[model samples]
Target chain A: MSGIRVENLVKVWGAFRALDDVSFETGDSEFVALLGPSGCGKSTTLRLIAGLEFATSGRISIAGRDVTGLASSKRNLSMVFQSYALFPHMTVAGNIVFGLSVRGVSKAEQRERLARVVDLLGLSQLLDRRPSELSGGQQQRVALGRALIAETPVCLLDEPLSNLDAQLRSEMRNEIRSLQQRLGIAMVFVTHDQTEAMSMADRIILMRAGKVEQSGLPHEFYERPATTFAARFIGTPPMNVLDLAPGADGLVIEGGAGPAVLPAGSIPLQLGLRPEQVTFASAGQPAVVETTEYFGADTITACRIGRQRLMVRAPGRPGLKAGDAVHLAWETSVQHFFHKESGLRCEIDPAAPAKKTRVAETTPQ
Target chain B: MKASRNALYGGLLLLPAAVLLWTFTYQPIVTTFIDSLYSTPRGRRPAAFIGFDQYETMFADPVFWKAMLNNFIYAFATIPLSMAMALAMALLVNSKLRGQAAVRMAYFTPTILPMVAVANIWLFFYAPDYGLVDRVLQLFGLGGQNFLGQPDTALAALIVITIWKEAGFFMIFYLAALQQISPTLMEAASLEGASFWQTLRRVTIPLLMPTTLFISVNAVIGAFRLVDHIVVMTKGAPDNATTLLLFYIYQVGFGYWDTGYAAALTMVLLVILAVIALVQFGYVDKRIHYR
Candidate 1:
């Protein structure tokens, strides 16, 4: 009863279709992240679900009720805005109990809930301070307090940690996840950062151009992206999606030598490889190291495989320099195939390999 | 040497404005006070030093008291009504839609019109039986009375026109303030299950206090400073019912040729305005949220 269900949500602002037939659902007490780049309709979808914006044609339900035409307040949900949206004029206590006061709860009850939320977020000392007087993280905590005090069955957050520094962001991330787990309330958050989605969300709904590109468990998105877009979007340095050409035997890296990597087909294909999966080895696909970026723990090395460039992650500094000849390797079974034009994932039997040797991939575009 | 040369150049650049302020503003205030201390010579009496004589006369004048009362009532009536109306109009126009620009311009049109012209136009609307107001009232079986000609309704009529004119002026400021308020604040309030009136009372009004303070101070000053509409419309008719302080000052100064008393009256009006502005900024400003 406490889950969210959206079906065929379409939002058209004048002539521009902001959201196109987007749909997803979250199970009871589930943590889902609407993940996409800006203008990919993730926020639009969230706004629609929150009843902030009405859909052109869609159905939205919350807690087993049809809330498609309901107001945000009537929908029985709470939202933490990207800006935190704390009232600048109100004190910390006033902000937390705003909803309770609005709903005309008794003073004793208000005080009880306010005490619980204030103590939960450690805002009791700052109860009398104005929002302007609080730090960004404190203000965010106040926002969370406001959302949690309502005791709603579901909570929604819109890129809530984007305004904080990297360190505070990670800190709040774990705090928010643990809070959600302890509360056991359904929470759906939206973010463009794959790391945030992957680390915090139990499931991720990745959107592109107003459509849901892929939606499933976090590991599913990492292990098998349904499209080239999803594959490129889900990984850091992004996945290498290379053009595949008809080779002497089968399909090879476009414009490069092969023991063909896949069986031949008329429709051009692509091969996807995560940067971490492709590592340097003694004997494998040969590449020219173009550039190397050192990041203390690991380094990202850019190498040319045929006509396309591929990014590979090397643990610790690789001591690899620009223009260095290198061999790239990955488990042959780990290669991902996608249709070149449609960008849709294409399945190839793992047992039927044109060549048994591991190979690195090239850039798709 | 370079700094001294730069200071000289800065003083040279400030000369024109300083000279104009001294000649017209600071000098007039000083001279008016000086004039208020002296008795103007008549045909049989020579000019004599009579410090505070005109001030005492101003205190004793019943018409001055009536004008003061009329002005306060007018101020009390027009300020809140116009400000509330301004806030309402600002809130209404704040939401985006088709022809929003046109609606805003229509609301602001009255503010840009000359007060004298507006007064003249309002005169017909306040006419005895054939005026727009009377005609509307006539249909409701409450007509045939002159709004500006009677002592009872004259000030009230003037107050109405003042509100109609000033609300638009104040609305521009409120509109700007309303725009500066982030939309998410309102959204958050709505999410809290706050109704329209509740949100208005809690968030909108509290956030708008700084603008309200600024508008209120301006409205108070304008109540004493503006008398052009009075000159064109009522001229303090029907036993001085609509006689504002500035208008009374004008009449005594120009009609009676009593420049000395008029200067004293000017001092009184100036002091009242200053006290009001000071009280508003000193007392109310602390309570407002600036940013």
Candidate 2:
């Protein structure tokens, strides 16, 4: 029954603002991943929510009770650090029971809770071992076990999987998601990796600088990016952004080997096409293949049109050479439009006039 | 051949230091052992070997035994108190308080002051009649007790001054240990629903163990070697209340002109210090497993 609400949260470090008047709400048992690049206030927001850090100016409420001035212990929230800061002196069982021991639970109850968490995390044999004896993945599980034994309403994880190897990260990511669902706890996870956010989060809050760019279902962010920064950040090989100038006929991309007339329904400003969306066509902008990366299932061809480089992900393997010429275009529905100066998306509504002002920004532009 | 040449160069560079150590360090210890077994006087003939009689006589002397017992009490008393005070001071200095640097400087000031200078200053403070301590006690209606003059309180008074003078030195080690702890653990503990005291006891204190053991061993050795303050201030007076082992050795060899008994006492002091060193190293070795 623990829902979290942040109202007008602001974090200012002397002159730099890390979280600038950000506000959001998480329903009961919701798993929200605060996703952004470095310095985007995602980690800071999680820390503030966990009471590891205090907001400069904001109101925080948990389960409808205001917890703005409460300390971490009083707030009854658990956090797993990125470094897996397990108590080095304590064994796994001892680490798991630390919170219960501090709360003055009976020895029997502490043992019961310890057994439950240890069994859940598969730490039976490792109970007698100290944190240093465990591998990185095992240490992470122990850290999560310590937090879980507390049975707090809300759990905050700050890049818990970032320290693991790639295969272990993916495995542990699924494990953590399943664990959170089983426990039915509201969780705020922070990560810079978009793949992690997309795979695990019920809702993803994408941020930039010190503000929320957009937060919604992962598919919504990718298919309809609201800002140019979000558009460039969300994908691998990323979205291709090319300059467009309004011509007498239609919107023609300015710099390519040969000019390209944008497909109908495309806005007359800057345009973006995801690498997967763009395809080599017989009749489109002329491009010289600069490099080709073979990734088994798909081949990403890096094409240079004058000064502009467009990445195209072909369906199958590509045998294109560095000096080969190719034509590139995308379907009208898949292209994104943004204002040239401000980088705000240009809405393509047929009901409105040819060009409109006063636009709003969304994430994944 | 290159390795041998490098070794030769290294050995050549170390020759002067090796010669100095042999002359200054080994020579004195060997000479002391030899001299302790002989009989000689200022205006007498050359020394003659007079084996275990000196050691036996010194054992029978009650004054020497009382001094040895007093030294043990002094060492145990001052070491624990000094180590505790050092730990407390380290915690205070490690905290995020305003004027922390100034507080650190103040705590460390006593360590830099020479022991003789400190004794001179404290002797005035514990003076029976016109001392600052008596004057302050009198303001609260608790005056007229001779601190250094009375046998009951003289050793206790000496212990207090020793702890006050030396706790800051041990605090530097504890402070280094405290600073080495990753602040992330403390933050993680907080998020795990641990109170400040719980974090201190569970996280900080356990991590400070190696430093504590190191400081404790050194404090015990310091208790034995640094009996000069008692020598300067009390002089083993008021029925030998504050008489320590090293002071007893000094009184026997220099003041009483009894070198054999002094050497026997010096041997006892050596054994005690050796015990402290062994325990320190053993505990540190065990601590490395956790570290």
Candidate 3:
């Protein structure tokens, strides 16, 4: 009630629903990231909260006040656009003070806010320069300055750092995080980059196809994903999903050489293993290394098991080469199982152990 | 030798254009300047050199001063009015409204129609009593007045027609510019708590400054160059009230057959256009951001 709350928000464009009954709430001073790929309704959710777009049927309130039917200007929120959207004709100071000036704030008050924001953003030397004259990083800072100077209850950012280069993006990400903390304002950051979300947001709302797949802390998303979609989306290398079918002995790896078993009543389970959970053991399911990518500290090796591919992350290169024979092994504790049809994560009983049958000796064809 | 050959090839490629430019454009401009220094020849008599004589006569002619004054007023009034109307029309059509294509085509119809034809259509509208305008005024129990008959109203009526003919053409350019602006900017402005007028004043208008400057230059040139409506509608009637510089030049050169005096008047028109171009490009252009 003290921060931003959106309930049952729906945005329909003709027949396609951009957002479907989306509900979320942010605490005061909470930084929430609407994380999703393109067309996942992340930006649309931000826009609806900013009041730039109307919800088909829902309620949006900020600071205990209902603003579902309010115009964007009256909503009393600020937004930083991906394009930085600084007025091309206005100087850095002009862009930052534009909102105050237009709201008919007293001249003395405008100058006071302007000086505070300029100093906060370190924009003293660049105040007189127009947007065109400023560099990309400077423009991004000015965009931040514009939003921060308003000192509104909530601030919405639509992929604000997406236009910057990698170095500047990380730098601004930290700046924005610290600024949000210093001001203790509720902020909703929308981004497709998991790293940006994980590094910046206190809460991550993972959306897929206009619906929330999962919403929790960043580590909660990585450790205990609610769904298979969440598991694959939250990690960098992504979780590997291998299909399994019932066999005479146990649940056999569908396209690979392995004799594995699922719990009773498991409906054609798919085994989910993260790359770091996989290792090159002395004996396990047989796979042939197909490719190896080195990234200074660690190496990710792509191994072919019959027709299915599995990625194994090994620290310090592991001296692996393509065409080498390897056996993949992972602890049952780290393994995640999901029903192949519904794609929902299946709960495995802690007392039961994953049964492994005969190790089939199959050579790469 | 290779460089020389390349230079020769470039010159050869430019030869036809240079020849045509000299033959048609440069030659006429130089000839006009030379001819302006002399008095036109009479029947069975040779022309005589009278340096500045045509200029002296032009300065003394009250009709010439009237034409100059009328041209300035026409430019000053029509340029800003048409541009503002164009921006409004562009904004209206740019939005996703019903029948938007039809509305855009309707606004642009006057630009494609010949000026003579448009003037003829306006002629009926301004025709003293039974005209469309008078009929509309009659609805208010007001009698129809001669719109194009009196000297005061004639120029004003012509000015209105020019604005109608020109605003739509300028709208096309403004529409193109307005479409190029990212829609996210509007969303960002609204989220920043900017009102509609404030966004237009701060974001839309400043971004459109380059386009406005481009349209203004064209409007200035067209102001001095266009006189087809004057020739068709008033023909400088009601005591030369609506006679523009170009129309007076046509009268002096073709009707009175005073080529020397007409050339002098043409030089004045050319100088005015040149000054406008210089002022726009040298001064105003620096303030406009290309993007």
Candidate 4:
């Protein structure tokens, strides 16, 4: 209640629903990320919270006050935009103090806040120059400085580092996360990049088709995804999901691979395994290596297990190349099972025995 | 040898433009400066160099001074008025209003219409008794006044017409600049607790400075070059009240055959334009952000 909350938020544009029945709440000093692919209503949700867009039907409250009908100016929040949005004609100091000046803050107070933000952001020397004269990274810092100077209870960020290069993006990601922690203000950041969401946010709200698919901590999403979409979206190489048929003792691969021991069930299920979980072991399911990608410290080998493609991460170079035969294996405890009809993850029964047999007859050379 | 041949080829490519420019533009400017030092030739008399005499006569002419004053007033009045109206029009059309394309077309129609034709139409509007303007005034229960026939309102009426004709053309440029602005910037401003007017002042106007500078330069040049409306409507009438510098130059050079004095007046106009161009590019451009 002391942070930002949205209840039953729905935004419709004519026939298309941009956000539908979205509800979430951030605790005090929480950093929540709205994570989704493009066109999934993540940005729309942020805009609604920022009051930049009016929700078709919803209620938004900031710091225990209902601001649903209020204009953006009355919302008492600051935002950093993807474009940086620095005023081109204004000096860095001018841009940073613009909101304070607009709010009729005293000149000395404005100067004090500006000085603090300028020093915090390392923009003291650049304060006299206009935004156009600064590099992209510097401009991004100025944008952050502007938002930080507002010192509002809530801050919104719409993919602020998207315009920067990859190197700067990571650097700014850490910087923004540290700054958010130091300020201890509730921030809702919207980004399509899962890494940005996972590395920076205290909580990640993954959205799909204008609906919240899953909301949890980064490791929770990585370990126990709520749905297949969440499973595939959170990781770098993504989770490999293989369809399996219900068998007598366990679930057998729908294709040529042997049975995998999961909890006893009759319904067909999709098995999800992360690239790191699947390993190049001595014996298990038969698989043929298709290709391998080297990432210096690790290598991910793309292999075909029965007809499904699975990526197996191996330490350093596995020395495996395309067209090579190999065996893929993983611990049954680390496997995720999803219902085939609905893509939602299925929980394992705790009473079931953990014993699982490795059928060497199905193992590849 | 090869570099010399390449230079020769480049010179050949530039020859046509260089020749055309020298013949039409450079030659006339040089001839005008030369003629300004000599007195106009009369019938059965040859022209003679008089060493600043033509300039002296031009400086002494009261009508020339009046025309200079009128041009300055015209430029000062029209440029900012047209640019402001253009910015307003651009903002209106840029919104998500119904029939915006049609509205934009209607606003831009005046820009495409010939000034001579537009002035003819405005002449009827400014006519003394039964014009459209007088009809509107009568509907308001006020008596009809001579808009163009009086010295007080003549130049002002011309300035109004120039603003109307030029605002829409400049609106196109402003609209382009407005469209180029990232919509996210506006959203970001709103989230920063900026009001609509504050956002317009801090973000929209500042971002549009380059376009404004470009349009202002054109407006300044047009303010001096454009006299077709004057020719068709006022003909510098009402005791030379609406006589702009270019119109006076035309009247002297062609109507009175005072070519030498006309050349001197042309030099003054050129100097004014040069000064404006220099101030704009050298000073204003340094302040505006191009991107």
Candidate 5:
């Protein structure tokens, strides 16, 4: 197995910078996900690593050798594309054996690997069927099988599960992660979906606007996002931010609302709260429910308070109506603070214990 | 209610076009079929109908059989070779290389030139002493053979020119098909350690089969219908090597002033073309695996 190292990689297409001095590394056998929104350089970074796109500057090393200018075929890596890209005329067995044949593996070894892949992917019955004759999920398995049969040291997946439906996406995501673990190959996955990265990656590199927002373990990023974009981008119902000015006690929540205290001498303050972090209570700033969505296990309530609207993800059976009024509260430990201008997180306060605070998680409809 | 009325009005607007098609297109085909059985002259009305006489006479004509054989050879020679050249050209133009626009324009320029103009240019190029072919052959100390003047080489020369003329046109279809293939597929193939030829054979060619079938069908039909170049360059050759079915029909119709026999030959050409089209569809239909 081989690890990959990308150092200050830059890619420029005329005046536009698709990737700007992006740098990161993946340990051997680690599953790292490059997670970001559209136009965020996540895919560009994957291409650079795969040698599909040439970086204008900097070096990329695989297994301690610089492969920056090598062709993708010489990179000792395998990739699965989002389109599945199964050969339309080739049978499932043919597709699986293609990579091995290209590498000049003997027929016996090719058959052995092919049999293993077919058995692992449950593709034995469909080996004779062409790509068009198979279902979308079945074709996806064939694409995966083709990549896996090569047994390359590094695997790159560019949104492999994006084309699959919701249920299949989750199923395939688990299957892919398990396969990577079992094989002990370093894998780099690129996706716009944060949930996929969070659930599957050993390390997640959150990127935005051709730059790295933050890079760390999933739990660490969830608890302490180094930047505002990371906190907002990594979570569903994203982090609710409220700008505040330095006040005498701590920091002002709104203009005249209670002081949501920060550590003393904290500069450029902004408050961050997740939707689930905020609790609805009776005695607080009243918010009228704008909408309520029932999701069987849990109900999400969208409510408006004063001039702000926010989504609240709470426990089972939210007994709230569209016109009902409620209050919002949160634990102090759950709140995140950041610098207003730079969007970087405020200094950590190790001495402060977990404390409760009252804030309205609502926005005007 | 208003939407339903608008839909009805939209369909009613096409009725005129439908009626025009029925009168102009459908009427001619049916009238031609009826006229193929009779010995009608140009100025005659209510001519005497001689059932199957013209057809029997057409079947026995040596010229008609020769034209039929020539047409088959012309189609068989042109379709596969031109399609292969077209596929190669499409692949070259599809690459991310410098000056791609200039290269594509140069390759596609032949397709846009009129057939008559191309034939005129090739005529001088095939001229005995001062022609491009002779000049090049003389440079290599080789004997300059008369290309368009000999019965043995006339059809082959035409076949070569026909391939040259039609390859670029078929390339347009292959280029479109190549563009439709996702770039991600090639990247995936490369990352799987596939060499250039392996990727082309395994990934690109299989996906391009549908476009190949469609282009071949059109190329075969083009080979049959287009004898304009032969008329300009060889005019049925040093003896009769370049006399295609359509050209033979022109000879019988205009040269000998035999419209009855020409109509019978026309029916034969139509039947042959129809069979070729049906065979193409049958072959393609069995193998088309669209994904």
Candidate 6:
């Protein structure tokens, strides 16, 4: 197995900078996900490292060798495209053994490897079937078979699960993760779905607008997001970001009179709260319940404190309704602060916690 | 009553197309077949039936054999060569190159111009001493070549012009098919360590079989039916070297006014085309991947 390192990778398409000075590395056998929204340069970063496209200026080294100028084939990396891109005419066996055939491997070894991959991906019965005959999930497995059969040190996947339906996506997610673990090859996958990243990756690199916003362990994205964008992008019902107002005691909630959460500072600030973090507390900040969504396993209550709204995730059948009076609370450790103007995480005061001050309750509408 | 009236409405709606097809297509075919079974009507005597005599005569005729040979050569030579050239041209324009639209337009210009006009232009090109071909040859000290007047080169010369004119038109089809192929397929091929030629052979060529089948059928029909270039350029001169099947039919029917023999030849042409159609669809169509 081998690792990949991208140093100061910058790719510009004439006027648009698709990737801007992005840098990251993967350890051998590590599963890393380049996670971000659409057009966030996550895919571009993967393509650049894969040597599918040249960076305007940067260096990419794979397996401790500079391969920035090398072709994709020379880099010895396999890729599964978003469309699967299986040769429609070739049978499953042909597609699986295509890389070996292209490299002019011995026929006996080709057959041996073909058998091994077909067995690994459970594609034995599908060996004779053409790509068109296979279901979407089967085709996805064929694509995986094609990539894995190469036995490359690193494999790149571009939104490989986006085409699958929900049930299959989760199934294939675990399958791919386990496969990568079993193979012990360094793998990097790009996805806009945070759930895929958070659940599958050993490390998640959150990108935004051609730049790396934050990259660390999966929990780091939830525990300590480097920026407001990172916090908002990595969680379910994404973290709510509220603007802050300068209060007499400290920086208070932006629009209404609420507890000053941080020390007063001239630099404007914002607060990040995860939907799943907040819960209904009797002796908490007073707010009005605006809406409630009943999920089978949990209930999400939308609470309006001042002018901002944040979702409160509570376990099963909260029996909450709109126009109900409520007080919302979360652990002090869950509060995330960012510089409002720059959107970068900043420390207002580590010592001074967001001490809840008694406040008047608003009339329920 | 409702079902019968609905049937009447459906039949009424189909009448115009059915009438047009029968008049323009089926009726002429039937009349031509009937004519092939009899001798021509003279000024005094009416037509007399002759069973298979015209076919026997046609098979025995040397000119008819020569025309068949010529048409076969034309079809076999032009179909593969032009289809290959069309695919090559399509691949060329499909790449990301400068002045791509101009190059595509240039390749297709021959298809756009009238075949007679193209033939007329090549006619001058094949002319003796002052012709463009001879002038270029003179620069290499190989001048005074009479390409069309010589029997060996006459059919070959016309074959060149026909391929030049036809390949461009065929290229439009290949180009459309090439565009329909997803680019990610090529990317995946590259990632698999397949070189350009390997990818083209293993992936592109297999996928393009449907287009090839369609183009080949058209090419086969075009080869047998083509007479415009032969009419304008060679006119089957130099021992009737360039007389294709349709051109020979035109000669027998129009020049000699042998309508019965011409009808017999037309039947042969029709049978050849029908058999080709059946063979192509039956044998080749089964193997192709449509998607």
Q: Output the number of the TM-score-best candidate.
A: 6
Query: Of the candidates shown, which would achieve the greatest DockQ relative to the real structure?
Result: 6
lDDT tens readout by residue for model 3, B1-291: 999999999999999999999999889989999999989988987778999999999999999999999999999999999999999999999998999999999999999999999999999999877999888888898857788889989999998999999999999999999998989788777776778898898889989999999999999999998989999999999899999999999999999999999999999998889899999999999988734
Q: What are the per-residue Cα lDDT tens digits for candidate 6 across B218-281?
A: 9999999879888888778889999899999999999988899999999999999999999999
Clashing residue pairs found in predicted model 5: A308-A362, A308-A363, A308-A364, A309-A362, A309-A363, A309-A364
Q: Between 3 and 5, whose lDDT is larger?
A: 3
lDDT tens digits, residues A1-365, model 3?
35788899999999999999999888887999999999999999998988878999999989889999998888888889888888777888888988888888899998999899888889999988988888999998999999999998788898988889999888999999999999888889999999899899999999998998888898888888888888888776888888877755567667766645454454778878899988887777778999999998999999987788888888887888999998877676677778888899888742365443323222121
lDDT of 5 at B30: 69
Kindly list the per-residue Cα lDDT of model 4 for residues A1-365, writing each as its tens digit: 45888899999999999999999888888999999999999989988888888999989999999999998878888888878878777889988998898888999999999899998889999989988899999999999998889898788898988899999999999999999999888888999999999999999999999999998889999999999999999897899888887555566666645544464577778888899987777777778999889999999999886678888988898899899988777776688889888999999742266554443333333
How do the residues A166-260 of candidate 6 rate in per-residue lDDT, one tens digit apiece?
A: 99999999999999999998889999999999999999888899988898999989888899888888777889898988876777677655556
The deviation in Å at residue A337 for candidate 5 is: 2.6
Q: What does fnat come to for each candidate? A: 0.70, 0.80, 0.67, 0.67, 0.83, 0.83
lDDT of 4 by residue, B190-282 (tens): 776778798898889988999999999999999999999999998999999999999999999999999989999998999899999999999
Per-residue C-alpha lDDT of model 2 across residues A29-72, encoded as one tens digit per residue: 98888989999999999888878889999999998889889888
Using alpha carbons, what is the TM-score of model 6? 0.96
Candidate 4, clashing residue pairs? none
Error at B204, model 4, angstroms: 2.5
TM per model?
0.95, 0.92, 0.94, 0.93, 0.87, 0.96
Which clashing pairs does model 1 show? A241-A364
Q: Give per-candidate clash totals.
A: 1, 7, 0, 0, 6, 0
Per-chain TM-score, chain A, candidate 2? 0.91
What is candidate 5's lDDT per residue for B194-236, written digit by digit as tens? 8788889888997888888788779878988998898899889
Candidate 5: list runs displaced more than 4 Å: A263-266, A280-331, A350-365, B1-56, B141-145
Considering just the first chain, candidate 4 attains a TM-score of: 0.95
